[model samples]
Target: MPPLSRPPRETRALFRNAGAALPTRHAALLERCVERRLRGPAQVLSGHHNTNHVLRLGLLPAVLVGAVPFARLKYRVPRETVEVVPRIWPREWDVLRVVCRFLPEVPRCLAVLGDNHSLHVYRGGTVLSDRGPHGRIGEGLMRQFAAFFARTAGIPAGELPPLPEDWPADGDSDGFLRRLVRFTEERVHRPHRPRFGTLFDAVGIPEDAMARFLRGLHPLTPRPFALLHTDVHRANVVVRRNRIAVIDWELALFGDPLHDLATHLVRMGYDKEEQARMTALWAEAMTRAGRAELTAALHDDLGAYLAFEYAQSVYPDVLRAALALPPHATADDFHAAAHRIGHALSRAREPLRLVDVPPEPHLIDALRHWHDAQNNPATPR
Candidate 1:
């Protein structure tokens, strides 16, 4: 028999929706932004909301195209002219410049392609997430992270790069706190509008509770601030040639040094035993660095930051849970989303004044409605 004829090539779609729980755009502009920096052809590897469209060059180098904060909006809420403008991302680039200068366990930035993309000497490494670190929660991994943060803490503020224009000019710690609270309110909580508000209402978060919680959190002592990676979960750490390399500096912030420890303790998925060990290791390291004062109230104050983290997380968590459902979602999808969102709301209940976490069935209806609305062109914002 004659050989079967090969099919004709079909053009790829600019946007991909299938198999993706969240809506994602190809970002041809960003791809071109990276390609301009390369000498030859580069093949796209992967693309997602939190991550850039990764492209692999012929042999070694890889390019990353970044996405704006919450770029993948589930609900297209109307925004004022002021709200449409983007914040300065040069801060992250400047942060990488500082980090690579001091920390050896980070990818070397090759070029800043633009405000939203950068080229780095891609350290061919395995992301630790694939290794079941979250499952094992070993002491060795905790120690490694502890030491990394300690070394980062030692990088003097004077030696660090200058702050961006929008950052508090006076360097007031309270100013930074207020900024964070505003960010939580305006960026995370506000963007989804009526749905986000409705979710909070159903959960029973009091109108003024979040504000009161922010005010109640006052630092008891004076301690110097340090740079923090701010999102140090397993996915951000890569094991390259047996050395751990941290990536994704877009969320870097300067604040209470102890806040970094708190963020790590919560975000790293450490169990009770591992959390205790990690806390002790962090305290010991800071104590050795002559900053014992920084952690003086960690046991007491860390709770406040952890609460803030959980509270800030609820918006994304709920949206993500809802988005995880497919078109005409099955009962199993509803159950799964309910479990995840309910857990998030429970963690944030105290800080957000959530009187009660809603039951699974209610979440199912809320999520199903929201999911369906995302597909409707004329859905109310």
Candidate 2:
């Protein structure tokens, strides 16, 4: 075991031989996060970095370790896509403390580490992904599950009391939408442009169109806002023998409730039939829970929210696509990247009015150019 206060360089060398040690920096971060806890002894059950460094820390009755500041862009043909790399370690302790108070479905938080990491005690069940790709537990379970959150509906103003800091600080619907667009622009899109500028140009994601979409989406009927686990996908949902638990609070936000459902539908791998059924179930649950106002315009407005999801997703999707191609990428690698990026652009076509997506060959050339530039010794990045 590494010492708790070990310098990161020494820590990296200590774990250099370990299989779980990804890169020196990632290994040091992971070891440091674990060192703060499990003082006696610990095991790294699994390691992954989606939005954070996730390590399942034990074999049975496991606790998950999530450490922030890990790399993202770890992708493909049209099979799957990476959405927004959510804000890492976003006041999750405070958010989870609030969510567990109102929603019984959330997993209990075991510990909040000093380093902005969290330990989520395993809820002792399987995530829905284990069942199948679509991960259906039936509409009865869905409606029952949806109704469990009915209380989120009808909470009077100031009843739940805002977080010490609301994410956007402006609770209006328009501000919330604008904030999401800004998150994509500032955090995901702009940061990597210098390194991957050509890829951005080739994908031709319409920045002005995204801005226009946000403006157009603002005036629609506003839904009552509630706390949303904005990243509610199949993996985040744990289905136990008795109860269900939603994990991962880092991306939770206070926003239109319908956005939550839209996120779930997109991320949960639901088929079209299941999507409709689940939507009905969710709406009934919200309406019965006294959130009729929120669901009132969902029929007319759900498309916009779903569109926002895809639109915001484009930033991360493109970044990940470019990052997937290695410096010495083969023809096959470029071909796959073209397919993947093409799929993402096509998904956003209708919503963002991406009228002119470049052909596959141009996309391939752009990605190769960007990858080579990054790896070239003479290139000044």
Candidate 3:
């Protein structure tokens, strides 16, 4: 699809009519933002699921205008948009502020309007779209990315608000992996029926193996919580001047640094060889940065965590495809999508075994109970 363009007169009119609150101060910032734009023709940067109307101007690079409140705007003159949430704008602003102080690679903050939003100017560069060849560099880039996060994670949590109250408990390796595995068993495997041709069947998750596999696995625990960019995927990274520029801070939380690494590894779709290469580089970087012990355990924790992540994705993928269906879509549409995701999850399970990490003892016992219940007609409920 082509990049999106500015809204039509009617569209703008509709926005105005929709009663979006236009901040008085934002009006001045919007004017200044447009004034700072390059003289060349501007184009709308599309393909965003967020509520921002993103445009690339010749002089300014990228500008994002929030469509909801009508006046909130952010400038990405030097880089791409990472994330925007009004509630945590202060925290994000503080993070960017600190990062810019230490890292020259980050874009410069031009201005922040009110307490809720800001604008930044970044130098532009190429973004890797294809997933195959970039795998090697992507892995190294992720290590560099981890190093960047480790710096922030080292910050004393006592100085912050004890991490956000809603932050995922998985910041600890054990909790993170256990939740992932449990989510898979309860949400994906439990829903399967013989007649349905569920994901397990499609992806070939062996009915017999599921029990033993889950039983033998143990969650690896890592000490010390660090600042984590929880959503570090291929899409969130940009390659500029031989260095990787990480974006998307909305999912930033205080947690296990390896979780971020694992999330990137899984999302980037690196093969086994590539994964090992990346993990080694990441471990080296962490070790050099004085996080050797945590880095060592991360290698083991990643395996179980990945299984959990893959299984977790199954439900969301099926749900997303289902929600995309036309209102009149038949029951078969939902079933087909669910089956596809289930199979994908099953295939994902194979890789988890390859990691050579074991599951937690409680989880092993639970899997055994579940296994016996599946086979025994009179098994306890």
Using TM-score as the measure, the top candidate is 1
lDDT of 1 by residue, 102-133 (tens): 78667554434333344444555788887875
Q: What's model 3's overall lDDT?
A: 0.50
Model 2: per-residue lDDT, tens digit, 1-381? 633322245443442221112445544554465554345433332212323223334221121122112211111001133336444334555565556666656654444444444444345577666777565667666775576545544444354335535454423555666667777767666776665666677668664656756655645565667766677676666788846677766566667777788887777767788878888888888777767777867777777778888777776767777777776889999899888788778777777777777889988877777777778857543
Model 1 lDDT vs. the true structure? Answer: 0.60
What TM-score does structure 3 among the candidates reach? 0.57
RMSD per prediction, one decimal?
11.3, 10.2, 12.3
Per-candidate count of clashing residue pairs (backbone under 3 Å): 0, 0, 18
Q: Arrange candidates by lDDT, highest first: which order? A: 1, 2, 3
- TM-score for each candidate, following the candidate numbering: 0.74, 0.71, 0.57
lDDT of each: 0.60, 0.60, 0.50
Q: For residues 1-381, what per-residue lDDT tens digits would candidate 3 score against the true structure?
A: 423444444544533221123457654756565555524344433322322223333322222232322222334322232222112222454555455545556554444444444454433565554333344564456567657666665555554434455444633666644544554555455554342233233333445433545675685665566666666666666677667776645446566677667767777777788777777777777777787766756656777656655645544453344334454444565455445544445545554343322233322233334334445659773
